[model samples]
Target: MIKHNVISVVLGGGKGSRLYPLTHQRSKPAVPIAGKYRLVDIPISNCLNSGYNRIFVLTQYNSASLNSHIKNTYNFSVFSKGFVEILAAEQTNEGERWYQGTADAVRHLQRYLQHHDYEHLLILSGDQLYQIDFQEMIEAHIETGAEISVATIPVNAKDATSFGILKSDEAGNITSFIEKPNSSLLPPWESEVNDEMKAVGRVYLASMGIYVFNKSILTQILEESEGVDFGKELLPEAIGRYKIHSYQYPGYWTDIGNIDSFFEANIGLTDDIPQFNLFDRNTIFSRARMLPPSKVSGTTLDNVVIADGCIVAAERIERSVIGIRSRIGVGSVIKTTYMMGSDFYQTLHEIEDARANGFPLVGVGENCYIENAILDKSCCIGDNVRITGGAHLADGDFDTHAIRDGIVVVKKRAILPAGTVIG
Candidate 1:
């Protein structure tokens, strides 16, 4: 069975500098998305739904929150030989350093991996949004007898440069591979573009960073090569020496590798029918929390997703994803924003004391006008605050917020003074 043969490893990314402030308190994988679930849940859920239960998450930087979330969320029955475990970077007889890159992270865990009985290792990115059945890819790998199988998708030229490009022969065997190729160096498109692709314009094959490797071949490659990363090092080297194949996935997939992409992916959920459907009863899975239903009073909401325990008294809110336990004051207008909401609710006494001390509680305040922005968890915005991501800022780092792809990001637990204006 696929469950007995495949061991899934989800890579928790390195110090997520691009997703700062959000990554400030939690690891990139632990960062919340779509109101309630964490980013790491995607890959783990996919593996589980696809009949693969043995999963190991590799993490190093800011892993406290990530570890907690995993511990609290994923628990398998002992009767079944299935478990989701965290393999943190540790000092051992083999090495004394942290994970250097993707390959190195897996290489360091070779000792533990050797103890597990499996035929293939499924490598996945922790911060991507998509639903895939790994069984299909596994079957393709077995059918082709491939030493390594890489999952790929068609991407336009504008987005191709951000991913590793690949060229495959008629049999779907990868002939060439390049990491983040320059536009000038990209090979011409050899495959025909379907009508759906034609509507989006020219397209090229791009790696999804999802790989399935034969256990023996993987062990051999890690031991023989000094490559630290898969995309930048190991994969390109394996193109000619090994039986490298490609599996094309024609579904919605987005890599949340940076702030701009993360912002867009979350906001995109407000669509009438999103490309990535969280409401699907069959595919997606995450931590299930038990809390009172969200309460909204005198608020005008449109295309919004309000999570559990949220209290909203705003005048108008449009196209927003409000997380659990969020509080919005009266007369406030939230448009095109993601409020991560709070981890825990403030006690009545704490709110009263904060009010007496002239400090705003952890939420949006009265008459605030916010648009195209991300308010991280537990942030306090005082009365009459206005935040608009209207400026064409490619990138910026400020005291109160950072601007990425024209979206204003207020850091986690940040406090803003009353009547503050940010653009």
Candidate 2:
């Protein structure tokens, strides 16, 4: 059942420089997660699960992969009015500059949005990892008679400094807002959270970068304000003018903003019960690939999430994620790593030719040891290659890989020659 009178706009973030080489060729939303799904799939899936299927993904930076992923993945029935469309930044009569910020992205796409019939607009960040019942949020908005609703989560003081903090009234109306406030100013910023959050020291309410706005108010704000951002400029200024309500969300949510957070989020899936439950009924939809099941030979695997079409002969793989079409040779020991795997399987003749010319294969080769690392898509790790990432190694960007926050990221399609060693 499609939810009527609502449209969702997913903000595919800017250059994503913080994610570095991972964003070198693809947009942030196109970055793969959970071994099989791209980051964009999370929000799109959430919208679909919530019965809000009419989604517009706004992207400005490298969007080729994101476009392809969305095209192949989402297809509604011909009789249905549901569609997931991509609105890329284009040079039009209005302006040619790329998205200045989150609000600017939406502002640029106003013409497209105005054509659609919607009472409310659901704006979401494409880089966040969580599953939310947006229908519940919409129902809350109607119940409170709010012109704007911001989803907030209780975060501790340390984490509060990194987000836009809010102070809400006893009635749940937002009273004040601050953008990444200073620690010294946090004494009086606590909001009333559930006892569970208070017990864990999460007293401050932080914006989750999720929002719902009335159509008329959203249009009015865009037409009147020159603000380029939501958290920074628009929301702060619109506090008194709009009936903004705070919708407290108690769930597992994380912003995949940088490499360290990205690495930890993927590795955390190996836990007995992950915070972000992928095994639940809220299915995360992605491109359907007709690939064979993973085949392992003599490899002892523990707490690993291995995707389909993998051919693993590793000596042991522990606490890691092996993505689709991964090929691990015999005697390789992969630990605490995310191997993004190959885009396509190499033909038998091509593999033989590469071996004949002493070239590395598409995936991890024999006798290799990799830890605390992320091997991007289609990387060629040669035999006997050793990569150990830790605090001891100085951070640097090299031809084959880059080290950020003690995690070595082997660039996409990079070739690490045989006997290559790094620490």
Candidate 3:
């Protein structure tokens, strides 16, 4: 199933302003999720799992960590030609400025793409959570003799307005497209969906931002079009010019657009039967860290997902995700939180020195209660600290943390003093 003729290009999105502190130091793709894996792992894993190995990730904003992660994690055998490389935006002779949008980014990198031998190109977004088989879409594209194919999902009228909706004929051929239409103009845009989807009021076909394109057609469009974005300008124009097909995807898919959605997506992993299954046959590959097993003592855990190299002595932890090398002191109560663990463990000497200086040590201290919060990497919560986040608190950003949509997000490497309380 090695798809040597197809090459994948994952678009590491722009500044990621909506996901602000998380994307402050790192790119969108490098943001951590599920306690251990990065956000970029979703699309790269989908590509690798579908037997397409040649990948080039196009990145522009804060791409150092993303580049390092890909280089260290995805090295194929010397006998195989599989590779995952990063193509950062640079000041070329043709263009000195940065990439303006998605289509502009791909258009700027066409010269580098010419060196690779591929028949079809698979375009993916970096900040989405879904498990899909791109081979099925590719097969449908070839079978229907389509020059371009878009992966679409059935969404309700309310949700369709936020996405690019497409209308397809009975033969699965796309007839028209619109980007984020208004509710008043939605009457004629409803496409046919299955009974199950229709029963749930999901009749509009929304673009998933996943596309398959014949190489020649893609090259031609890029060369002739000066459009900056695909959804905003390119795809809408190509609907009638090309034989575009709609590949309907009927599985679980959620866009990790902002802090609220990102928090819920991680917290959802603690569910008994989560929508995005992580334990399925498709493995999400990441950097293999050599760490010891987690050790928990005197803690009553309920529906929590903890990663490797953790030491916990909490009184109770309910519905939470604790990341690697996390340490929770005795008598703490954690509920509905995501604690991204430390990058490197602190030795006893360092911890003692920090405590002697009246500074908070890395990880949570004794008798702390943290609920509905996200503790970023290497955060130090002192003893007797309490953080209860909910609608009672207004949205604001502070020196140490930010509250958005009733969720408190402690900034990376922030320090909370002893006896501090937040709500």
Candidate 4:
């Protein structure tokens, strides 16, 4: 195990443009996941589990909900020194522009990082769903004495065009790199399921945006890379000047950057061999400790994952993930979906600020039924509503709330009145 002192800073400062409708009012990393948790939780939890405490989260667009969630849910006030802070874009020594790219975000925070005496600085994205034992990667980086050790996985050559495809030596030393190339040059590794994706099996030790940087080298790279990013600029220079290496992540990892991928990741969790490690008790992903047991009043569930403190009253839920303290009323049908409450309250009555800044109570309307669809966290619907298929609806017309991928995607805290047929 390569050993080095490290501090992790998550790059969550994007508009999360692809996750529209859902991200219309919030940042991508702040986007809810697994029913009751935010996408950012995956990385934050990893940091804690991996023995790193001090963290800084960078944010740019729709940061209100993201900031509030961090403040309310991730209460690290117990630790005086170990803290989590959000760094919004500001008029830095660099300029007064919003974060232009990945490299720029770190560039802007160079001074803040200078104050810390960490041997290494790990950079991660807040919008991914994976359980990475970063401690193991840190060990490998220290042992190799590499300037930059990227956490990578193998990918097919055909799909490598979309990423910085690496041609590494047998010793795991990266030799060449290509960013997002065409699939015609695909590699021979057993391609991961669904290789056609933007970053599927084309892995080939491609950057998972999980970088272990020598803190000293980072400052230098940032200075030299005036307008650089992890993918576009600094990596190329690092590979040429330093002993850049690759550490294969044999575990499950998914970058749910877009709509289809995001949907699949949610559905992916239900698989018998789930790619994520929700059951890894040793990990640091924090779930609220609730006292009351779940109350399934009259609900009929089959092949479902229901968390603690839930109340299912005569609802038919199948192949779904239900978060803690959520209420599903009677005669409702939920399938192949994820339902999580961001309120963190034991019951609707207990929630003082039910909307929590325009956020709605987490509930499925009585007698409402949905199939092959997703209801984002904290969304509520009225009774007798049907969400079937509408592959041909426009945004401003037909289906009113909001149009995402030709299918209506309701945002968090938005109420759907009774008898609403949202196709």
Candidate 5:
């Protein structure tokens, strides 16, 4: 039992199409980020920090990575009564259809939800990065008696067209909702960037993709919908009916849907003035000292955010993120890269012209020298390998390996032998 009126549900079962190659072998929520952490860690960690226990993670697609990560990383077993459960869509009496949409995913879990006496059901996507107090949002929802209270973020006008824009009234009550509306078709409140947008504020309220639903209303909507999505089906249908309140969470949040977004979000952590603070004491996000401190000895590191348990040699690492216990070989020069400290080998092994998909890109110097390249997790770089060529690119295929235009994706645990070159 949650002991409270709220139970958090993390929707971890989306087929991440935007993160194609990375999701080729794993789910999007399981994709590695900031070197050592996965995409699911963002919301789960947020839940833990927000003081919301009794969580249920719904998963589809390739979920082995997600399952392993949940088991190994979060320490879910310690909870005597409060537990985190993963509900994978199995062949039931109905049929074995993959999750159709977000609404459908939740609808499938109605059995468990129906049994709970909680007043509110908090639904969250497991792939976003943010640190906001959900307890505050829950309080607001209860105070307003809203049918559905959504968490919203104000995105720049240029980015508004890409999201499911929510047009709300002066009282935080949603008025009009549009899913990825065009510049010309927007409301007058949304401002246009290139003399086109019909809306003002470029400051339209969109879903952080998170929601707090009154359990009764949520059940009613799901029962009516049978199987539908929040963005595509539910929200569109819920307009002008019930109290669909929007809980504005104005904070640092990013939906890591692509390589560029993922890479940039990770690099943002190294900024002198970071927009998103992951280590804030506000208790908006939880803290876990699972790993030891990062080790930097014979290396010269300048302007880098290094995570726990790392071994750095006499290598020069600058403007890069090193994850837990990662090994930096002697004489290796790393720059403008993000490496997950937890996934690296302690020894300088034979690596290939590879990547950790979107993870610690094992960069090697020219002699041992590498420049401006990304290495994925467990990628073996030979004794001497170079991922040279700092050419500006957007999205293209590199023969067998697909680069997101400019980004070089290294697959997990790939081994590149000595004397190799990757462009």
Candidate 6:
């Protein structure tokens, strides 16, 4: 039953300055997650799994890698009327400026969206990690006959202040919305609390940045309003004028807005029973690279996720997510770190040249101690290097690396000399 009358749009992300260095070369959506997949894959996979295939990913800053990944990964059969497409920002007679905000990105694409014969527009953020069936949300929207439905999740008071909070009436009709409200401004939970929620503790509703809007309503709001963002402007303005509702989602969802959250989200996957399951048969799709299985020689790994085509001769690896084509030399101890492996393996000649040039081959060198850090794709760490985030340094940006939330972030394709110490 192809009843989902929806066309999905994923906001590829803005400047992505919060996730610096990582976003230095690639867009936020292109940032590798779970060792193998990019952040954008989550929303696109969700749309596909929910039977909503006609999707558009809006991109602006540093989109080459993202565009390439999308092109190589998502190819629907000709017979299937489903296509995953990229809608890069462009200058038109209407405007020449880049995407101002989330809502502005969608509004500027109205020329294309107007032609699509869809009932609803499913808007999502590309940097979030979660799995949801949009069909269920759509059904709820249809049942309530709402002009717009904002997907929400229960968050504790501490985390609630970081998100757009909402209050609903008994019937799930959204009454008020506040964007990143302070502690004093947070409203009490209006809807009934479930037993599970009560047992966990007091929690408030936070907007997940996922929204469903009727096509006509979306068009009308964009046409009438000058607001650039939905949470900060459009949605709040529509609260009284339009029939807005809240769809509560009970699932594991995290907004990887910054380095701390991104690191925690990736490390959380190593849990015994992770909130987000990558092993589910329902696939979280990505660009399928033809590569051999990962090879580990005498390495003792615990609670680790090692992706394909990796050669690990490390002495010990604990609670880490290793990406594809990673080459870890002997005696290295990687602990609670995320090694986003290389884009491509170094050729024998390149390796030899690197060695001759006194640089480690495009991966971790022998006897390196990496802990509480993130090694971006193709990072070359020399032998005896120490990258521990125990110095309690909040943030610092240097030529070869950066410290974000105390975690050392070796920049993409950065080269650290032998015996380099970063603490």
- All models: lDDT? 0.90, 0.95, 0.92, 0.72, 0.71, 0.91
Model 5 bad stretches (over 4 Å): 1-3, 75-80, 187-202, 282-293, 341-373, 388-391, 398-400
In model 2, what is the error at residue 240, expressed in angstroms?
Answer: 1.4
| Superposed Cα deviation of residue 188, candidate 5 (Å) | 2.9
Model 4 residue 402 distance off true place after TM-score fit, in angstroms: 4.2
lDDT of 6 by residue, 1-423 (tens): 548788999999798999998998889999999999999999999999898999999999999999999999999898988888999999999889999999999998889977778999999999999999899999999999999999998887778878998889888999988898888866554345687875775468889999999998998999899999999999889988999999999888999999999999999899899989988877899998999999999999999999999999999999999999999999999999999999898889998898998978889999999999999999889999998895577689999999988899999889999999988
Per-residue lDDT of model 2, residues 361-390, tens digit only: 999999999999999999999999999998
Model 4 regions more than 4 Å off: 1-3, 73-80, 156-161, 184-203, 287-292, 342-362, 389-408
Task: Determine the C-alpha RMSD for candidate 5 after optimal superposition of all C-alphas.
Answer: 5.0
Of 4 and 5, which scores higher on lDDT? 4
lDDT tens digits, residue span 55-150, model 5: 888998899977877766555446444667778877778768878888988888988777766888889988787777788888888778788888
Candidate 3, 5-89: lDDT as tens digits: 8999999999998888888889999999998999999999999999999998999999998988998899999999899989999
The better-scoring model by lDDT among 2 and 6 is 2
Lowest summed lDDT across 10 adjacent residues in model 2 is found at 1-10
Question: 26, model 2: CA deviation in Å?
Answer: 0.4
Tens digits of per-residue lDDT, candidate 1, 1-423, equal 543499999999899998987898788999999889899999999998899989999999899998888899888887987888988898888789999999999998788888889999999999999999899999999999899999999888888889988889989999988889788876574355567975786468889999999999999999889999999999999988999999999899999989889988999999999988888875666777888999999999899988899999999999999999999999999999999998888899999998999898899999999999999988999989999886565678888788888899998888998899988
Tell me how candidate 6 scores on lDDT: 0.91
Task: Determine which window of 10 residues in candidate 1 has minimal summed lDDT.
Answer: 185-194
Q: How well does candidate 2 score on lDDT at residue 284?
A: 95
lDDT tens digits, residues 269-374, model 4?
7777787756668553554565378888777787677777777884688877777667777898888666655464435454446445543345775788776565
